[model samples]
Target: MARRDFPRRSDPERSPAPREREPGQTSFLGRWLRRLLVWGTALTLLAAMALAVAVFVTERSLPSYERMKSTQTGQTIVVRASDGSEIVTLGPSYGRWVPYERIPQTLKDAILSVEDRRFEDHWGVDPVGIARSVWVRIQYGQWRQGASTITQQLARNIFLNNSRTFDRKIREALLALAIERKFTKDQVLELYLNKVYFGGGAYGVDSAARKFFGHSGEQLSLAEASIIAGLVKAPSHYSPTADPDAAVKRAKTVLGTMVRANKLTPAESAAVDLKGVKFASEQGQNSARYFTDWVLPQLDLVLPDNDQPIEVWTTLEPAAQHAATDAIQANVPKGAQGALVSLDRDGAVLAMIGGTDYVTSNYNRAVNAVRQPGSAWKLFVYLAALEAGYTPDAKVKDEPVTIDGWSPRNSGGTYAGEIDVRSAFAYSKNTVAAQLGNEVGFGAVANMARRFGITTPINTMPAMVLGSSNVRVIDMVRAFAAVSAKGSAITPYGIRKITSTEGEVLYSHRPDPVQQLVPNYVAAGITDLLQSAVSIGTGRAAQIGRPVAGKTGTTSSNKDGWFLGFSSGITTGVWMGRDDARPVPGLQGGTAPARAFAAFMKIATAKRPPERFDTEVKLPQWQLEPDDESMQANPDGYFYADPDGNIIEPGAQGRTPSADSVVPSGEQGVPVPEGAPAAAGDDFLNRATGRQNEPPRPKPKPSQSPKPN
Candidate 1:
């Protein structure tokens, strides 16, 4: 009873009373202790608020408009043809930029409905919209939605690399908030429009408009604008180039979104009027767009934007281009491809054909191709010798001789016994040329080729004297032009001048003529010899009824065929072959490409006067070396000795090689028999029956060796 009275307050089933405890312990707290605990919590909250304010103040401020503007900027490649017509294209991607006033209402409505309904009202980060997006994403069990405003997109594109990381997300949020403070809603929309990609080489609304409807941004129709707007999420999936049907379907979905968001009433949606729009031709407007592709890389080094809007005045001659193109299309044999180029005497490329049809295949045969020049290389060999003071009349034995394990053969099967330089060239005797190249120093021939602008990899082996190494058609044109110009080596050029759109001159190409190569007489000799090539050698098919000088070349097995010749005023080079190196049967430079050359030059040289090389240059006469005389024991119809010590001949084994006599296996170079008659005058240089002199003997393939230090 006493315990109950003493504790009267300590009821087990009700409220307990305070209890005394040891030094640092208490059973229940008094009113003062409770107040202290409450006050401590309030102070802790105040400190946290102060720290947060300090953090907010510490962040460096950045301009919102600058961030937005940076995001929308992109790279664009505007290609213009040599004729100054726009063609082809490429770009750096972001949002498709459009002017605010030019944006279609339909496009604006669709984008707003899908991306940010309150884009105009929010200051970039919309709390309510984010909450709604989170709810939707959670319900869908995946992140299928976002609440990012246009400003957020700008922040991500401009200041961030394309990475999906948490840090980036935080940065995006901060940047978005900053952007809203600087740019107006309309300005932000404009930046967004100009920054996005619509695929198919389109960047920004203006580019997209030009690409899809062949019009500017201001002229875009509602349907065109909607199509572009639909490409925001995935440009490739909705691109007309990649998937037109998918693009249209995506555009329709955008329209549906606009309807659902009440951005467009049902009646308004129905009345908005859209027709399926057809995009511009993916190939572009310039007819010679492939040629433009050839010129762009060079122009990038000399223009504004590194690629666009520069007016490039070029040396392209439409007439020459048409002729070359028509010739290739009409003459390239089945299963065989070909290329051709025409240049003025000054080495300006008037016309270039990359291939038979650039649209079907973009490989540039005119410049990129590097194949054996075969006997055509003889021009350089002979030129070097002539420059070294040897005359075309100089006698060299056409007999087979081995040089450093390489036995160069004549184009025919047999070796001519004795031959003068001119006859050996006309006949394309491999043995004689190889020997001559060796005598003059392989370096001489190589240096001569380099001076002519043959910048490709060179094989300095003695075999290169016989055109054993590879050379490009463009380089060959410059090389041949040296012979046509009588000495000066002119650099080949396509672009003549470049100017900004505002008409300020940026760069101009001056004809860079250099006399680094053959002297005038030596050049004339080479030219005269090459004239024989078209008149009576492997390039007979290229012969025109004018003073034309050029060379013909056929690599072993007909893997390559070429005819590079020119008149006094114009130089043209033609090549025919497969890109994959497949053997071309029943085709040679003399037949197809040579024919094309003839056709093009017929039109090209119609108005030009007949001109001949200056044959009066007092180059020293050449005598037949004894060693060379022994090799000419089997001389073919290709060589003859003159009192002046010069020999002239053609490549055929006899006056006329029987069709059956033509070598069957395409391996060995053509050979000539001994005692073959010398070519009399220029007629002696002309081919007998328009038949290619047999290809020269195959040199021993060089050994693969490690380069020496």
Candidate 2:
């Protein structure tokens, strides 16, 4: 068979014979190379088809070019106080639109260094970055390397939702290509700088600069720019306000990267440190968030429902907000809640503290919580009496009285028999308030309250005269604001102007015609009564030397302590109580509430021009003679005397309020006379606190530092 192998091949039906080894035939390795090339070519065709299918599917899901071009950034609602300071921002907070040329070159370089070093060289989708990110992901995990270019991020932010899926990533890549084709590199960079989000409810590099460094992006220092650049990686993780140590650490990394990228010299980076950067503390920024929250809902009433960016200018005063927060933090007792609301004569809210710490409880006591006002409600009762032709010196019996089977007792369970109207109001005599309500008619008092802006339900019961009816702190503040406005009807408001970022006025608060809630003379009469209350009565602790008028109120069982005062065209109301209405021990209106009012007004009115209450009306002297019958054997006799003709409450003995109205010495806004005795004025506070003859000293903090926002 072997000898006939060639002849066997000639037989067509037989199997082919084994061929002899031919000369110069291919080797085994060559065969293997051929097989590998064929298989590799087939795999390359299949992969190309897969990529084409992926691109097709992703492009179909992508937003239209027109949609992407017309896509507007999120509508930002920037709310600022009247002083042009930001209180809060609703939705996305955008800063001033900056052109590419205006973008800080250092910031741009830092961003490029940290975000994508080949940003200028890439055409939206970077092959090198994608390969590296893929390798990193394979070694580590997905999301470990974003591999997003500047244009890619812009595309994702502007055109895509934040869905971390492979499909969305493909769509983002397609959108980035489209963006790069439609826009220039410089334009893409500009949009990214203006659209990126920094932590703390701020968006854009400009806002981030202003937020962290208190300057515009154009004014960013190299250090500040580096810090902001680092935030783009993880805003919440590296924010200056959120994690200062992390922020500084990340910023140093950015500087190092910049040096390596040839964008910054090592010496230049070494010369810059954030040590004295002075992260501009908006001293009263968070303190006024309550007012911002209040004004936010009202924007719906004024603005159209379109998604256009807008700016809201509110009536909040930065100084007033700081003062209110400082006072409440200083005087409000531990385990108790406190709130304060201050308004200008035009009914514009200057400041509002919803609680001791907004971080703890955002339940706004100023506008939401309804509670008994105690004697503070007497503001309406006495106002009604004045409207009924009662004078400040008019006599009203302080003897026991009953109405509708509800008999209210005086603070100390005893009342001076037939005191003048001023004395009765100053002493907070419940009996006198009862009699005045009876004479004025409870309905009339309720009408007066309504006229002064109290919208809560009120009853005609006699106890209502002693603040038995529940009301909001804002109601009391508005009523007092009416008095400060010389009896003009005051409608409490916070928003002063609403405008577009383009400077178009959308809404402006128009000054309404002054509607008289009470005659000017009646207002003056009530002012006299309130002034006496602050100077000598239960509200003695609320005196701040300048012409001040106020009233103090203490609910039954000491469940609530309140003080409402006005000075220099500003009216402020303070309330302290437990959220559950449980009694706060020894919490009288004269204790902490009045002290907060005094301290707040002292700082709030410091920059305001000195003002005085008009007291030209001819009337009987408010100062009582020594032979006054009410002073003898009275319940408030020895425990309450101001030696200077003012009456102090027994509970508030030794610490008399500033009796004399002293002019500001123009030094630090303190009203202490330059040549006066050291132990004469505020020295009384020193004596009570065991630091007699010394200047007013700041009290020690009562609790641990507040939680971070």
Q: What is the RMSD, in Å, between candidate 2 and the native fold over all Cα? A: 19.1
Query: In candidate 2, what are the lDDT values of residues 506-580, reduced to their tens digit?
Result: 899987888877656678889999999988888888888788999999999999999998999999999999999
Task: Score residue 136 of candidate 1 by CA lDDT.
Answer: 88
Q: What global local distance difference test value does model 2 have?
A: 0.79
Best by TM-score: 2
Model 1 C-alpha RMSD to native: 15.1
Cα lDDT computed for each candidate against the true fold? 0.69, 0.79
Question: Model 1: per-residue lDDT, tens digit, 1-709?
Answer: 5555443566677876677567865546665687788998899999768644543542245544544454333344444446655545545522234558868776777778767878978877899888987998889987877777787887676667768788887778777765666567888787777766567756677777777677777777666766877888888888877888887788777777888988767776565444557777664323265567677678656564543344566677766777878888888878888888888988787778887676688878788878777777877778767765567677778897888888876655798788777777877888878777776667777877776778887788877886777888888888887777777777777787776534567788876646645555676677667766667766777777777777778888888888888875899988888888888996776878788999999987777788766655554233343222211112343454433333434353255533433333552354433544322332332353243554433433345221211
Candidate 1 segments whose C-alpha is farther than 4 A from its true place: 1-60, 63-79, 84-110, 131-145, 161-170, 253-276, 284-370, 382-447, 455-465, 493-529, 535-537, 543-548, 556-559, 567-570, 576-584, 596-709
Instruction: Judging by lDDT against the true structure, name the best candidate.
Output: 2
Worst 10 residues of 2 by lDDT: 626-635
Can you give the lDDT of residue 691 in candidate 1?
Answer: 37
